[model samples]
Target: MAKTRTDLINQVLDRLNILVYGQSPSLEDVQRADRIVDGAIAKLASLDIYYVQDPGQAGPSGGAIEDEAFLPLADYIASFHLLADARTQALAQIAEAELRTIAAPARTLRTLRVDPALTPRRYGYYRGGI
Candidate 1:
C-alpha cells in the first residue's frame, strides 16, 4: 500500500494529537481512520486520469481524426494507470519526509521505499499499534 493524502494527514494528525493530548487514540478514532482511508480512495478515482488522444482517433476516413470526442476511452486507461501509480509513489515520498513521526529510516531504505507507513514503507506511521 502506498500513502496518499489521507494517510499523510492521518499520520500528522496522530502526531499532533499525541503531542497535545499526551496519550493514545480512542477506539472510535481508530475506526474513523479506516473510514477516512476508504473515502480518500473513492475520492481519488474521480480525478481525470490522462491527456492523450483517443485510440479511435486513428480514423476510418484515412484522414487524421480531428475531434477529441472521437477517441476511445481505453487509450486513456494506460495513462490514468500510470498517473495513479505516480500519484501513489509521490504520496509515499511525502510520508517518508515525515519520518519525525516514525522510526528513523535508513538512507538506503528511504530510497528503496515510499511511505513505509503504508505496506512497502514499514515505517509504522499507523495509529493502532503498527
Candidate 2:
C-alpha cells in the first residue's frame, strides 16, 4: 500500500522527535508540515526525481506517490523545514543522493548528430578538419 501525505507528515514529526508516544502535534504544525511536504514534492519534480508534472496533483487528498522508497526523501525534506538543524540538513542531503540513485534507472540519455550538409552557414569559414 502507498503511504499517504498524513503518513509522510507523521514520519517527519517522528524524525524531528516532536510527535512522541504520549504527545500530538498541533494542527498548525501539521499544516506547516503539509506545506513543507508539498514543497518537497515540487522540488523532487523540479529535479526530475519524481515524475509527477504538477506537485499539487499529489496532495493529501489526491493520490499519493506509489513508490514507498521515495517517502524518506519527502520525510527528510519536511523534517528539515520543520527544524533546520545540522542533523536534519545532513539527512535531507543524504535522502536527495539516495533518491538520485533510485531514480537513475528510470532516466535515459540520448545524443543527436548534426549533418554538415544540413548545417546552415553564413560563409562556412571556420571548418578545418584535422
Candidate 3:
C-alpha cells in the first residue's frame, strides 16, 4: 500500500535531521537555518561585485529597476537553499492552524521569500553561494 502524505513528510523531515540528530526539533535546528539564511542575505549585499565583470565596466542595465532590484535579489539569493517561505516561517504555526484540521502536513516545502521578484523561478537559484 502507498504511504500517505503524513508518512512522506515524516520521512523527509526524518531524513533531513540526520545532520540534525533525527528530527525532534530543537531551538538549535531552527535557529541555525535562520542564521545561515540571514548570512546569505548579507552576502548578497556584495553581489554588485559579481555583476561587475570588468574593473571599470558598467553592469547589467535596466535603469531605475536595477537599483530597485537589490533587496528582492538579496532575498532571492538567501532563499535559494532555504526552507520555508517568509509567509509561513514556522511549521509549528501551520500545525496549530491549517494542519490542525488536516491529519497531515507538508514538510518538503519550497523555500520562502517575500517580494514577487524573489521567487525561485525569477532569479534562478545558485545552489551554493554564487
Predicted structure 2: clash tally: 0
| Candidate 3: regions farther than 4 A off | 1-24, 49-130
Residue pairs with backbone atoms closer than 3 Å in model 3 (clashes): 84-112, 85-112
Tens-digit lDDT track of model 3 for 1-130: 3332222222233334323554464445434443443343344335322231111111211212133233233233333334645543343233233322332346778886699676567566678964
TM-score list, all predictions: 0.26, 0.65, 0.21
Candidate ordering by lDDT (highest first): 2, 3, 1
TM-score of 1: 0.26
Top of the candidates by TM-score? 2
Q: What is the C-alpha RMSD of each candidate to the true structure, in Å?
A: 24.6, 9.8, 25.3
Question: Sorted by TM-score, highest first, which candidate order results?
Answer: 2, 1, 3
Candidate 1 structure quality by residue, lDDT tens digits, 13-100: 4433322455555555444443443233333234332221211211111222223211222122212232335644454444333322
Backbone clashes for every candidate come to 2, 0, 2
